[model samples]
Each structure stands twice: as C-alpha cells, then as structure tokens.
Target: MLDVKDVTRMFGTKAAVDRVSFTVTGPAFVGIIGRSGAGKSTFLRMMNRLTDATFGQIMVDGTDILALRGAQARAWQSQCAMIFQQFNLVPRMDVASNVLHGILNRRSTMQTMFNLWPRADIIRALEILDRLGIAEQAPKRTEALSGGQQQRVAIARALMQDPKIILADEPIASLDPMNAQIVMDALKKINVEDGRMVIANLHTLDTARRYCDRVIGMRDGRIVFDGTPDQLSTGVARDIYGADASFNESATSTAIPTDATADRVYADAMLS
Candidate 1:
C-alpha cells in the first residue's frame, strides 16, 4: 500500500516533479511512462527517499515516509529496493558477495569486514540468484557477466532484502531488445511470484503496455494521465510525449518480443 499526495521537488527555479499524486493498494506492476526529462526518475527517487520531497507527503501504510529520520529512514529505504539501468554491482566482487551486500543495511560492520555472513544468508542469496536465472554466475566476478545477467544480479541483490516495493529506473535502457525483454520478464516474474509492488520508470510504450498492470503518464514534471494500459490510446500517448499528429509512435517501442516472447504467446497459447 502506497499513497503519494501532491509531492513536489524543486531545484532553484525549476520543479522537476510537481504535485504528483497517486495511490497503489496491494500488489501491482505500475509503469511511469514518459520521454526524457519528464521527471520520471526524479519522482521514483523521491519515492525511494533518495531525494527529499520539497513539499507534500508520501505515505506507506499510515506512516509519512517523508518525515522519517535516522534509522527509521534507513529502514524504510531498505524495504523499498531500487534497481537501476547501470548494474551498480561491485565489479571486482564475486556475484554472490555483491548480492549478499543487499543486507548491508542490517548487517554489522564486523561481520561485513570479516566476510562472516551467516550460512543461512549466503544460502538465501544463492536462492535469489537461482530464481533470477543467474546461479551459475554467482561465483564469477560481477564484471564478467553480460549486461542482462548483471541487471538480474542487481534484482537478486534487491530480493535479498525481502523488500516490499521495487523501484526500477530505466531498468532496461542500456541493453539490447532481447536482453531488455529478459530483464523485464524477470521483474514481472518477481512481481507475480513474490507479490512485491513494482514501479518502473520506462521509456518505451510497448514495454509498459505489455508488462504493466497500470500506467501513469508524465510530462513536464506533472502527471498528465493515469489509467490502465488499455486507456493509453494514441492521442493520450501523444499528449504524454508532446508529439504532433503525424509523430511516429513506433519509434518509442524498445520491446520487440524475442523468440522467447513469441513462444509465450502464439506457441504456448496453443497448449491452453
């Protein structure tokens, strides 16, 4: 359960996120769709409390997340995991250790210094890596893996926290279309299987329509549209992107369903 009311963030004379408001109850995959500079990333940052809101409130349950301080703030951030376009893994560290570091918020300094993680935590990290389809890469150095694999590693690290909410900022922007689909599918899988609410800042309309349960369209730092994917019509999308009538929407599609997607659609549909 998350509620954001009139939240705004300003930089000098500029407002990057202006009076954004929404409520998401229960588990659902929500996509914030927009072009560059639409304040999508800033909005997610504010939700994660990595950047403070200049005004208004973000409530998780009944608690005002903006008001939290010290350990409480750190605890809130831990429960709200973030996955970024850049893998953010320690390149020299083994994949398993990088994933295990997700627990750094709660682990003691001595334990981290001595690499004395409990057996159960290590096993849990392996389990998360396995679930993300990167178990084999666990022992390898993080920099050795492909972009998609590394992103999954990032997701595994987030899952290591048993987080309640997952915030993905331009999650697949740096990958090829195929790898992008893999990462998106992995995120969807997590949302479905674990019931963790996923809020992603997505540049591609096709990805949002195909994956998200709800879509929030932003433009010029304000929420212009909020509805189901089906409601994001051509006109609506045009307004969100500030495009002219002849503007080609196809250019915004980064998700071109791989053979994996086709199998899940036409091929797998036959079995049902």
Candidate 2:
C-alpha cells in the first residue's frame, strides 16, 4: 500500500529521520517502536508528506507522494487519515460532528456552513461509530466522553474518510491500560476486518509486539530491526532500547482481560 525508500528528513544540520526505507502491503499492520527522540514520528509524518523529506521518496498506490502538490497532496492526505496521541477533535462539537469532519474534503462551504453533512455521510459516520462501539455516545459533546471514547471518536472520524492507510502516532500514549486496549483493538480490527493498512509509531515494545503484523525498531533515526513479533525477544529489544527494554516483560501475561467496551484491540492481532 505504501513504499518508503531511503527517506530522510533534516533540520538544518541535524537529521531527524535518516535514510529509512520500508514497504507496506495492504491489510498489514506495521508498528514502529522507538524511545523518545528516535525519529519514529518523523518517519510516519513523511509518509503523509506532513513533513517534507530532505531526501527520499514515498510511493502510495504507484504515485510518488513527494512529487504531488496542492490539490494532489490534499487528495493524498485525505486518503491517509492520521490519528494523534491526543484526540484532535473540536471541543465544542458533538462527537458525531467531529467524525463527520473527515468528509469535509467532499463537502462545500455552504454545506459545511450549516453543518449540513449529506445523509449518506451522516449514516456512514454513525455506522463507523457503531463499528467502534461508540454509537450510543454520538450525541454527547466530545469533551464529555472518556479518554478511550474520545480516541475512538478520533478513529471514527478517520474512518469517515474511508482512507486506504491509517497512521497513528503514539495512539495510546495518553490512555490508561483499559483505554489503551480499547484504542489498540479498534486499530487492529480496522486492519484485519476492513483490510486497511495501519502504520503506528509506538513507545511501548509490548504494544508493538502485541498489535503489529511486522515490527520495525528505530534508534537515533535508523531502522535497526524489522521482523515478526516473535522475532522481537528480550535480546532484540535490549539492542533497540537498552536494558530498559526488560520493563516490557510484564506485559507477557496472557491473563490481561479485554474490557467489554474494547473487544477488538490487539487481542488477536499478534501472532501467537
């Protein structure tokens, strides 16, 4: 679904993302794991052209994203929805309206002026909310929802775009364990059932191993490891994040119960 070749990004003399390359086939869930300042976020943003690369190319559906401009870039971005660590919803808008914002690219100023989302779009948004199991909260103010619900609302908004690729940057960073599971599960279902490609930058190795089909480890702006979850044992993690990688050992217990509200998270995504 996406191809990144020798992608690099620099800030004057500093290289934030350095010569990273990878391929993402459709219906795959890929995780990027790294410590703080490791450039994982820079790498993901480059895929959407959110940050122009100092060097390298990103190909999505055969078009070189680096070459696109204006409407073309906007069109490409619309096809690649991004979910941030902080659910970036409008605080004053109702949950449903925030989700509908995903299709604003297809709506006009007049339609948007009156919040007149088409019936089909509205229906689709509602369906996405239901799929995420947050349909009952659609009428609530975004700020009134719980952290997990808010993040699911963000996911629903992304789904409203009907995107080909979903980029989640530290998606569960702000959530509690239960909420994290809920958010991660939604992402997993999107990849498995919906067949959309998912690429997420993760801080926790446990989450990466739990949720990703393929794991890519980054350090100081370069990919150090890219392989199946089973391949990321303690030694490999130690190499990527040093001794602290052992901290992830606690997540090994299969006993963690899935909250009823978030059934689809990382539960079955990881290869056993």
Candidate 3:
C-alpha cells in the first residue's frame, strides 16, 4: 500500500501540489486526468522522489519514502519506476541495451559505467521485450522504432526494474489514436497480468476510461474527483476539464471497441 499524507510541493510561493492525500492499496490501473498545469505531473514525480514534497509524508508499504537516503533512496526509486512522455531511450542504443539499463540500480557502478551486463540480465531483457511483443526489434536502434514501439520499450525498461509501482507521466500524449490505444493496452496488461500498480497521467478522457480501473481528476493543484470510470459522468468531466473545453468525438463516449476491431481500425488509419 502507498499512503500520501498532506503532500504539498511549493515552488517559491506557488504550490504545485497542494496538500494532497490519498491511499492506494492493491494493484490498480489508475489515471490522473487534468488539463495542462493541473499539477498531475508534479504529484506523480513526488511519489518517486524525483521532486521533493515541501511538506508531508509518503509511505510505501511500511517505509516512509521521504526518509530513505543515498543507496536506500536509489533502491526505493527502482521499486517505484517511472515512465516518461519522451520515452527517454538512448537514440543510438539498441533496444536490448536500453532495457538492460534498468538493472543499473542493482549493479556495481563500475559495471554500469562500462555497460557490462551479466548474461542473466541480457536474457531477462530479451524476455521482457518478447513479453511486450517487440522482441524482434531488440537488435534495432531505439530511434528506428515507431512512437508506440518506443513507448513499449520504455515500459519494458521499467518492467526490468521489477517495480512495485509504475508511474507514467503523460506517456501517450505524443502518439496518434492508434498508438495511444496500443500503449494503454500494454499498461492495462501490466496492471492485470503482472499485478503491478500503474498510475498514469492521461491527456485524453477516452483513453483514461478505456484502460484505467480508477480515475483521479485534478484541477488547479487539487484533486477534484476520485472514483471508478462509470462514476465519471459528463458533468463531472466538464467540471474536470472546464465547461468551455472541447473534447474529441470519442471523449464523451465510454464504449470502446473490442481489441480486434481496434487493431483493424488502427491498420486502416495507418493505410489511409
């Protein structure tokens, strides 16, 4: 379980994350939905100590995350892996090498600095790539892959950490509709099949509803709503995104197509 108690992050006088409190128990695919500068990214960063909270405590399981220092802090960060919007892969490196980098926290500094991974770690990286349906691309450079594939590689890298939680910060904001759905499906798979908690900062309402088991709506550095997808009605969405905001056609509707149909649509979209 993760407990966030009165967590707040202040930049000078401005509060980026304001006295937020929440508890997450068990594995869940959670989506943090908000418009730009709603403090969603800041909240997620604080969870992994990427950005320190000016006040309050974040306890993961029985340990206070804020109390960890040096090696312990690095270990804690490994357990709570993060995925970024930019993918963050080395453009020139092969996919396998990129995934293997996840084990750096567990490796000696000399070994990591020299890029010398053990055989077992190499095998594990390949397995993760296969599991993510991109094993064939292992030999290819990360920059050569499509946006969706690159994102999957990023996820594979996170999985290699064997993390207890995965925090994705607006992971699919750069992709097209097809790629977005694929990435969401991959995240949902991790949450369901691997039983890992996935907390993503989602840009679109439709993607959040399609994949997340729970949705957290944020507005101006505060959590406005927390509920299941079904509870997030149009009025609530309006409240979250603001009344004058315009959404895509699919955003208002919650009924998404089956996986097979979604793939077909993607194929067609690509062809067109």
What's the lDDT for candidate 2? 0.82
lDDT of 1 by residue, 167-188 (tens): 9999998888888998999999
> All models: lDDT?
0.85, 0.82, 0.83
Once superposed on the true structure, which residue ranges of model 1 sit more than 4 Å away at CA?
244-253, 258-272
lDDT of 2 by residue, 140-240 (tens): 89999988899999999999898899999988888887788888989999999989999998766567767889999988898989999878765676566
lDDT for model 1: 0.85
Q: Give the per-residue lDDT digits (tens) of candidate 3, residues 98-155.
A: 9998877788888978889889899999999999899999999999999999999999
- All-Cα superposition RMSD per candidate: 5.7, 5.4, 5.4
Candidate 2 at residue 187, lDDT?
Answer: 96
Give the winner by TM-score.
1
Tell how far residue 27 is off in model 3, in angstroms.
0.4
Which of 2 and 3 is ahead in TM-score? 3
Instruction: State the displacement of the C-alpha of residue 34, model 3, in Å, after optimal TM-score superposition.
Output: 0.6
Q: Where in model 2 is the C-alpha error above 4 Å? A: 244-272
